[model samples]
Target: MSDVVLREPAHRVSPRAVPYWRLSAAIGDAIVAIAAVVAYVVVPGMPGWTIVLVLLVVAAAVAHVVLMPRIRYRVHRWEVTDTAVHTRSGWIGRESRIAPISRVQTVDSRQGALMRPFGLASITVTTASAAGPITVDCLDADTAREVVARLTAITAATEDDAT
Candidate 1:
């Protein structure tokens, strides 16, 4: 028999974002809550709507409690090496990307109602091609902005160097 093990790279930086489940649960809860309210007002006397609304609320609540805390994530790292910016994402199943310092077109950040309470945000790095937009959701708002700013600066510096 043989045993094998793997370790995280020594230089890897932990992402400054909340778990995906947390975001998902919050979104689920919000939608369910709104639906519940609508059901109550529009179909309060109907047993089926009431039961469905209650079930949704219970399911969302359970997911929020049981699953959100168990999920994990890591933000993509921006190496900003001489020629490229490396962006990686994943927890159990990992996906990685590298953009030549010149290829990054824009960086954007977003915060939703659910994320607002947790003081979290998302940063999306866009390339010229539509298919290449790399989005890292669940980052802290300020941290997301800082990361974008740094990438922008790096992109600009690389452009200057190229010229």
Candidate 2:
């Protein structure tokens, strides 16, 4: 019922996030590349056109692995203000979400196996919104913990029932 004007968040994710993203992308790409190779080898007397297609797929995968991380690093950002938490994310298309402090229900931090090697974590803020929780990914582990703690304090201090 209300118009929400959105703006960019104030802080970029950790610089280490770039490499973390790159490594993640590379792992996926590697799997794709391997599948392509297996297909080529398993199919006996494969057509020349099929070989060309496989090479194209491999090339595209390589390009995605190389480019996506840098683009994501530039686009992902977050800011926690006295009244709200805001986030911007996505590599190809952008998404921005904001949760008022009074509406925050829970704040959690987590690190996946892949993220731990890079000392990175993600923070999820559960809010009383139909759209679902908002997550700021690839923060430094300590920063993520601090953010969770700060949000807990802010939301606890608010008088709202967080419904």
Candidate 3:
């Protein structure tokens, strides 16, 4: 191999992914909002601040549901190569990881109910290390499958050398 290192460009998931993220975030926030509303309604003589607090909570949740997906999409990226799997993800704290194909023990592709509607899936690449699996989320379904297949083949080739 040449001394020059290879790097992959960053990429975002499908644009349709925004709705899936929004819906999931909204659903969780709605559950919390509903419980808060029930408490306000059922409790006798609740403090006036409770009303203000609930409204602020809901506004913040709405803002998150509307905004976080775009941020997440922008930050997440993955690439699979014969030598390694590279990923960068997360918003609050960004993480970049590179797992050599020789270290990969398994690869999987999974889709949730929300992801299925948008034809999105997530790819997981597992290594023997304690750091846990690396995941590429919100990929196009076909692309996720292809990545899994390619990673599997690449890892398999290294098994003999590892032994």
In model 2, the worst 10-residue window by lDDT is: 1-10
Overall lDDT per candidate, in order of appearance = 0.62, 0.92, 0.82
The alpha-carbon deviation from the true structure for residue 126 of candidate 1, after best TM-score superposition, in angstroms, is: 0.7
**Cα TM-score of candidate 1:** 0.55
* TM-score for each model: 0.55, 0.93, 0.88
The full ranking of all candidates by TM-score, starting with the best, is 2, 3, 1
Judge candidate 2 at residue 152 and give its lDDT: 84
Off by over 4 Å in 1: 1-20, 26-65, 74-83, 90-93, 160-163
Structure candidate 2, residue pairs in collision: none
**Candidate 3 on 98-151: residue-level lDDT in tens?**
887888877888999889989999988888768899888889999888777777
Q: Candidate 1: how many backbone clashes?
A: 1
Alpha carbon deviation, residue 73, candidate 1 (Å): 2.5
Task: Identify the runs in model 3 with alpha carbons over 4 angstroms from their true place.
Answer: 1-9, 159-163
Off by over 4 Å in 2: 1-6
Worst window of 10 by summed lDDT in candidate 1: 6-15
Best by TM-score: 2
For model 2, residues 1-163, the per-residue Cα lDDT tens digits are 7799667899999999999988888898899988998999998999878888889889988999889999999899999988999999999999999889988988889999999989999999999999999999999999999998888888878887889
Q: Candidate 1 lDDT, tens digit per residue, 78-127?
A: 34454655656665466666656677777788888767766777777677
lDDT for model 3, on a 0 to 1 scale? 0.82
